[model samples]
Target: MAALTPDTVDIIDPDLYVRRGYPHDEWAVLRREAPIYRYERANTDPFWAITRHADIVNVSRQPELFHSIQRLFVTINEEGSPAPDEAILRQLLNMNPPEHGAYRAIVNRRFTPRGVQGLREQIDRITAEVLDGIVDRTECDFVTEVAARLPLAVIAEMFGIPRADWAMMFRLSNMMIGPGDAEYAGDETILETLQRARMEFFQYFSQLCEDRRQNPRDDLASVLANGLVNGAPLPIFELMSYFALLIIAGNETTRNATSGGLQAFIENPAQWARLKGDPSMAAGAAEEIVRWTSPVIQFTRKATADTNLCGVPIRAGDELALFYPSANRDEAVFDRPGVFDIGRNPNRHIAYGIGEHFCLGANLARLELQVMFRQLAERLESVESAGPLHRMRSNFVGGIKHMPIRYRMRPRA
Candidate 1:
């Protein structure tokens, strides 16, 4: 890998993510040379990129100092902080301890190991059905046909959303995270695109909530609609934002991870073969894939008071981007960081994030990935890139969006 120069320091550029799947070598330099390097582009306040594993842990641990409410996206300081009246980030993100904990607890039980374990049979059924859709075809866009399908279904079924609406849910989720991409944004500004998606999401979910209230079901939607926090009903807007986050955030991360996982197997066939040789390795392989692919690239944190992180200077109101992809590969934490070993041990990857805001769906995602590779190891005969792989032009949900794969698979039993 070439040295990163001043000409190449614009790591936040969305184009860079699309070009290299990620700026891995560049990030490697940051992790090695400057774990907390301040990054700046034109017309915006600079932010420290927290590239090392330890530094990220420190930041995540002190959520009170590094707030999550004012900014959930990387464009936080750039787009201006989410205002009190207009910003629902407080609901989806930008939260402090007690508020964050109570809100997160609503669905926390369902995503626990014991909770997600109950869904294993359903997950297997969905995985088998999704794979079955692509098995007969000699070629398919693995992203749309397979990787993107199961998570959408899992979340929709959890919400009691009808199967017929999964496609719309998928499209809407992309619009929420993929506004910077030309395919989703068109001529609109990113804010405009996000706002538009939120508006549509709000309208649809409001009706969904109303129905759940009138005719409750034993599902996540009903739980949320009727859910109580401090013995009071959740505020309407906040509840709506939670619904939006569950659909968009919950759906996108797993979907992108599954796609990125397959891409990893294709690139590192030895790992694929290793998994094929032993289906039981699926559990560890799934973590390696998440660590390797890092579907959610960046999340923002803001400083509430003066602080020094890993011997670096800091100040109140300072903003930082926790580059999860880079942190997952920190040489200090991961031995032979560049290698992709399916059985890599002590895999403390933060792909699902860490600390207070650790991804609520982490257990579910792990199960989904484990199940996916297990079946693939057992059934997939061969898989390779059929055409040029294309990544989503996103700085947020880093993913391979157009993965055309040529493959053969045994029929589902």
Candidate 2:
């Protein structure tokens, strides 16, 4: 590939993402030459690409300076503004400051280390069961079978959703998050698919909300339904967005991280050997996997006022794309950014992001990854790819749509 200039590189294009996994070559160029490169492309809204770790941290930390509400994300194909309904759906991801805190407080306790710790036995059971399904098989699609199962079951159980409805949650999340991929995009436009997904979730959750209200259960859905935000019930739209965000955020990121982490181990057998040798390294390995995968690819933040980032000028409304993957790989931060080291010490990758709007599900995600990988390390004897890897055609979420692997594992003990 020719050396890409800021004028030539189009990082937001989903097609480019599908053809080539991340544009690290392009990111490296920008990181070296222009850490805060202004990205301008036709049709798509122009924004500054913050590639370096320091700059990303600075921008992410100062949410007041760079607002999250102006625009929640960067779109690959921007035909026009966000749909009318999309504007009304407010969640922690798009909220800023006091409001973000208040909303997050609703379930914050439930996701803290202590809160998530309560689910350890549950997570372990789910992991063992998932691994058990693959123990007798010589080959399986790790993405769909192994990686996707734990998170889906865990989140559904938390919401008090029936086992039958878990598949709907999975389908809705895929359509909403991976609509750029042909597998889920179908005949509708991306925006259309997204809008339809929101409607379906609203319809489903609306009933769940009503049921939970009348017949309250000790579940997250009941909590949200009866919970108050600022001394009042959560508006229908916010309630729906909360459910959607949790289901997607909890499911998608962890699923991709597990699948991608396994791929990393396969390519770096030394790391795999080290992990298998010491299952205690599972916690550090989980952190490394999150850093390596950087599942939530990029989120857009607009400048609330005229402010400069890393010596780059910005107008009040100028948006900046915080490229998490690039930051995770910045040479300034990690000793060997490219190496997949499971036992990397002092790992401070901001895959969950930084500051005010950091992922609310961070603790839960960490717990899930740790349990899954630890179980695999102890039980999975040998593993290798069985077929080509198929990745989602999505630049937003770094997703592994399908990963076939032939592996040996000990049966549940």
Cα RMSD for candidates in order: 2.2, 1.6
Q: Please give me the total number of clashing residue pairs in predicted model 1.
A: 4
- RMSD in angstroms, candidate 2? 1.6
Provide the clashing-pair count of each candidate structure: 4, 0
Number of backbone clashes in candidate 2: 0
CA lDDT, every model vs. true structure:
0.83, 0.87
For residues 109-161, could you state the per-residue lDDT of candidate 1 as single tens digits?
98899988999999999999988888778899988888888888999998999
Query: Ten consecutive residues with minimal summed lDDT in candidate 1?
Result: 76-85
Q: Write the per-residue lDDT of candidate 2 for residues 1-413, one digit (tens) a residue.
A: 77687677777787777778888878887888889988777747677888899998999889889888634667654553355236635788888888888999998888888989999999999999999988888899999999999999999999999999988999999988886666886877777777788899999999999999999988999989998999999988889999898988879889999999999999999999999999999999999999998998898888989978766789998888899999999999999899999878899999999999888889999999999999999999999999988989887898899999999898876
Best by TM-score: 2
Q: What's model 1's TM-score? A: 0.95
Query: Which residues of candidate 2, in runs, are more than 4 Å off?
Result: 78-88
Evaluated at residue 82, the lDDT of candidate 1 is 34
